[model samples]
Target: MTFRPLLALLMALSVTVTASAQSAADLGASKPRKESTLPLLPTASEADAALISAHLLTRFHYDAQPLDDAMSQKIYTLYFKLLDGEKVFFTQQDMAKFAQDKDKFGNAIWNKDLSAPFDVFNQYVLRAIDRMNYARGLLKQGFDFNTNDTYNVDRKNADWPKDQAELNDLWRKRTMNDWLRLKLAGKSDDEIRKTLDKRYAGYIDRVKQLDSEDAFQTFMTAYANSTDPHTDYLGPREAENFDIQMKLSLEGIGAVLQARDDYTQIRELVPAGPASKSGKVHVGDLVLGVGQGATGPIVDVVGWRLDDVVNLIRGKKDTTVRLEIVPADQGQDGKHEMISLVRQKVAIEEQAAKKKVIEVTDGGVTRKIGVIELPMFYSDFGARSEGDKNFKSATRDVAKLLGELKAEGVQGVVMDLRNNGGGSLYEANELTGLFIDQGPVVQVRDARGQVQVQGDDDPGMAWSGPLAVLVNRGTASASEIFSAAIQDYSRGLVIGTPTFGKGTVQTLIDLDRFASDPTTKPNYGALKMTVQEFFRINGGSTQLRGVTPDISYPNNGDEKDFGESTYDNALPWTQIAPADYKPVADMKAYLTQLDQLHDARGAKSPAWQLMLDELAQYKKLSDRTTISLNFAQRETERKQLDALQADFRARHKAIDGADSAQADADAQLDDGLNPSERSLKTELKEQADAKKAPDPQLQETAHILFDAVGLINANPKLAAEVLPYGGKQGNSASMAAVAGATPLPTQNSAGQSGGASRAPAAASSSGH
Candidate 1:
């Protein structure tokens, strides 16, 4: 079924120029009638909704439940969440009016009727405009920042305001809080006003920028999310962007951009990309203007749309593009730092698996432990599918690294999968194959409830020695699979915090291919549908309850908001029959000894103690959902936190001594700054060593591996238990797991360049 263009839907709906004259509806109650003056935004027609609804019910995995009245109400409820996540926009009465058609959503969607959703969007636009006007007026009427009012930063769970009056009061405090935050940041009153004025203006522009396509995508996603979180609709452009991200090789500057007010901010640098390698551009830098090669007139992109700015920046390889950037450290003084860059095919190789050997002393004997940091499980699928002999994939790269490590006589291996958000499913399976001789790696259950066992039967093992997998809350999806399989096989010890718990597999389907009409113009787009759930060979699923580490450290990230458990409609974890497999050895008792060793070592280490304290403070800050509007109170809190942070850095630096400056410089480089520029400021050693420092997690994992090596050596019998299954049966496979040098993009509120877009859905897959 070829999905129609959003414009078609818009045309079918009343055009703004053609809208009939009608009476104005009060902002207060009085149901929005068809004749209301509110400009109706374009939305899915009954035909559009019916086709999508059919696709969801018939083609989606898990036999996606029927679109009944209950689902309709869910879709309606989710729409509000997506539009006004903070619960600060829509009022109680507005919700009540929208609720009248709550159950009608499913039916309307089934019929391809988008009147209700469109009508609601129109009302939202009106409300937003009204609020924006109120906010602009307040910018002129500055208030006392010394007021004792506290503005809640997060209002996701708060009740909607009863009326405009209540909302005005809330916005008043909110405005004060915004102003105070800037004041505390050291901005002058005049500067603060300009910054906020631009910010608020940018917000208004964003609202106004919403077109028929935005509405269709937003509402459709909400509807799809009611069925499952992973399922989402991406517009044609968004779909292309998704492809670019997944491929991790884009023909651009190789810098991830995020919209911040009227500016496109450089969030991070893709390692090895032209911009990163040049070492001139830094993260947190803002692009104020763009110019073509050599002396092309610089186009001020300050108020340009994000996509428009992106288009201006992106060009063919070898092309020169100059950017006027605002230094990251420089507050919004509007000063520009101009830099020129030649565009290239920036491969995200930096995030790729990298190998390093660290020496750890245990029992007065130093063991050379190899560490392989696999950022994201990625693969050059195009090359692999073409049967290229030198296909680049996570598995292939790691296998090569294993050989090098073994050649180097490393006694143990630590696979650092920390912050790996996961990627190719095929790579995950193949990576697992490198460690194990053979066995089912993961179980895949489709919409029909049929389970397909995906396994690696490669007999040629790669350095099957003492192993450890380092993870954190950012580890997820394919990374979780690899770790879980390792844990199930008793192949390695998993370390770090609980993972992000994303086990479901998503397949991007081109909606235009499914269109009923073969010759439709402007193909609708693509749908990323969660088609299957991944289960461990041992019958446990790694859905919401992500693969828990065998050993853990102090977790500072907000777990409530970070993991899959945060989603309300995520698939519940479920279990199935276990695959035929035998573990190398039971490590439960061994883990106890390892944990004790870690604790004892941690207790004596000041660096470790400092990290724990820092984490505690971080968690305290993260848990806060509100801040005082009083400038003095906020300022005092900020100073205290800053003092504590400074002290921690000092202690940390003291601990590193000679390596401190280099480490600090490298840490600063993470924001995409030029290492040379930063190095000039610090008394750092060579730039090469600057990037290498004492990684607590890697250190801890190496130590644990040393202990594992000791235990295995003490019990020679356990070491002798060799792989039993193999035969070269094949398949390809699959967190903050690393973006490996290709630094995967980060997402934020203002349309980040990369990362999976979230829909309104949550829950856990049922599993062990």
Candidate 2:
């Protein structure tokens, strides 16, 4: 209830502002001409918005860093990186020209002078057009992949081309690499040539479409992000999209998309959405083409804008949309697969918290453990305000599930917060209340250096048994709060990898509200600024260094490639005075024994070994920045990669005793089924898939929990100390305290912004 007013303030602030596969040869035959246009310039309104945003960020942002000449240089560098990050478009001469005004960016932004940024962007557009045109020409020359020449794939740190000739040579090698990838995928030389030609044409067309708003947004975003990664300037269209994402209801295939290089990549799938139900889509997968209906032509989509690609995938309810995607693990081998899905409104119920039971046996004794897979910290604010007693919320639903698990006589529980990008801050507080007695859950520090302790005032424990909180790199914001609270209280064993370090809290500011001219007509976009940072009850902040699990699993991803630490301007982790609360029990004493058992079991698990091997292979592949252009060499490498993948699959099948082919068949929906029957089939398929691939990390967590249960049972004193209400688990007095309490007031849907990991311009969810 303490957070309700803050939530209300945020809601009030928000109220103001608001495909196709083309076949290679036939599809690419015609060249799409680029429209000649004047240089894009910032409009009067955008300039005003930029000035207003600069004022707010400098005066109110949590970082509290002054925007002077030094800050100007940061914005300048960030702008160039965003414009031509790959270093394939601009030359060293272009950089030299841009460097002349590098120290003037801050002053220009403050003074509302937009000419410098616009001029730089115009130059970038021209360079991009020239590069694409040169690339198109190379397609006709036909590549000779027999040479041992290599192409560098990672050019972020590479030097810019010194001249036009050097730039041309870079394009030549890039064109050859593209051809080699398609050739490896079994496409003929003619098809590859046509595809490359069309791709470059699209690239040029996209560049030609850039307008004043796009330029303004990019420049302003660079200015904002220089303060902090989470801070951003959202244009009108983008502000609307952010609202939709928060609502979590869309009319597309239910996938969150982000642009990476020339491809639109799947960031995450909405639960129970068409894409997730189809089971063919996955995170990190690159979408290549989109088609309408089952038989529509698959239009080439490479080099298209993120929003354009999203529009292509979204359609009316029940309409079929097809996608051609390169699997995430395939890594530019050029292999692709087509998947068809029906468009529908993503159901909120599908994204709600769900429960299942996994049985863990150790020393011939089996223990039933409840696993609650929470996708996000969600709540229906609208339903709650209307006095709907059963309004949905993470804490409410999880409470009911805990009662059910209790009835089933489970011994322990594993809270699976993996990939939960975070949501409602109120729900996070109440959810922590479910596991611990009344106490501070997290501390919030404002830009003014004022600290506020947010905690659950509610008096009962939902579950007092041995518990383990499972997390990964995707867990962030509110998720980090709950995990850190549990760890601080020693109420549960935090398992899995370090979380996504997003401790900063952001709020949307309507720029139009602050404009001095009333006649401006509200076209000024909003600024999402960081106003606060989160600290755990133990006084440590979860900013750049997320909660490190008490027991860490082997991580497969590079820490540098993911999480808040990836941002150069991210706020540093800090601390505050520790909150006054007693930990249920110190988990450190039992960690050594538990770890020994875990390592021993993993040593004997073929699946675990396989995961390690795959991680090693991934590391090896990730380290390579160049690829040989020799056709024979590339063919042999491709064969070796294929053989390795085949071996991994075969070993996995042997371990799980599930045929991959059969699993695929089970996932497909039969066209003859009625609507109700189709729904039933989908549900059955989801269950079958879950059974087919049991989560190794989760299974291991369950084992760890069982081990904790055993340890507690062996030590009566420890058991007594661990139990809630002084050895009385879920006592009648605690239950009565909660039963008579007033219902929690509903908070605004935008109380705490989620997923600080991405900039608004880069991420989008398709549909309304």
Which pairs of residues have clashing backbones in candidate 2? 19-290, 19-299, 20-290, 20-298, 20-299, 21-298, 21-299, 22-298
- lDDT for each residue of candidate 2 in 409-528, tens digit (9 for 90 to 100): 677889999988777666777788788766888888888899988786655566767789999998888899999999999888999999888887777677889878777665688887
lDDT for model 1, on a 0 to 1 scale? 0.66
TM-score (C-alpha, index-matched) for candidate 1: 0.77
Local distance difference test, each candidate: 0.66, 0.72
Measured with C-alpha atoms, the lDDT of residue 567 in candidate 2 is: 76
Q: Go through the candidates in order and give the clash count of each.
A: 63, 8
How many Å off is the CA of 93 in candidate 1? 2.2
| Residue 174 local lDDT, model 1 | 76
State the local distance difference test value for candidate 2: 0.72
| Cα error of candidate 1 at position 384, Å | 2.3
Error of 1 at 323 (Å): 9.7
Worst 10 residues of 2 by lDDT: 14-23
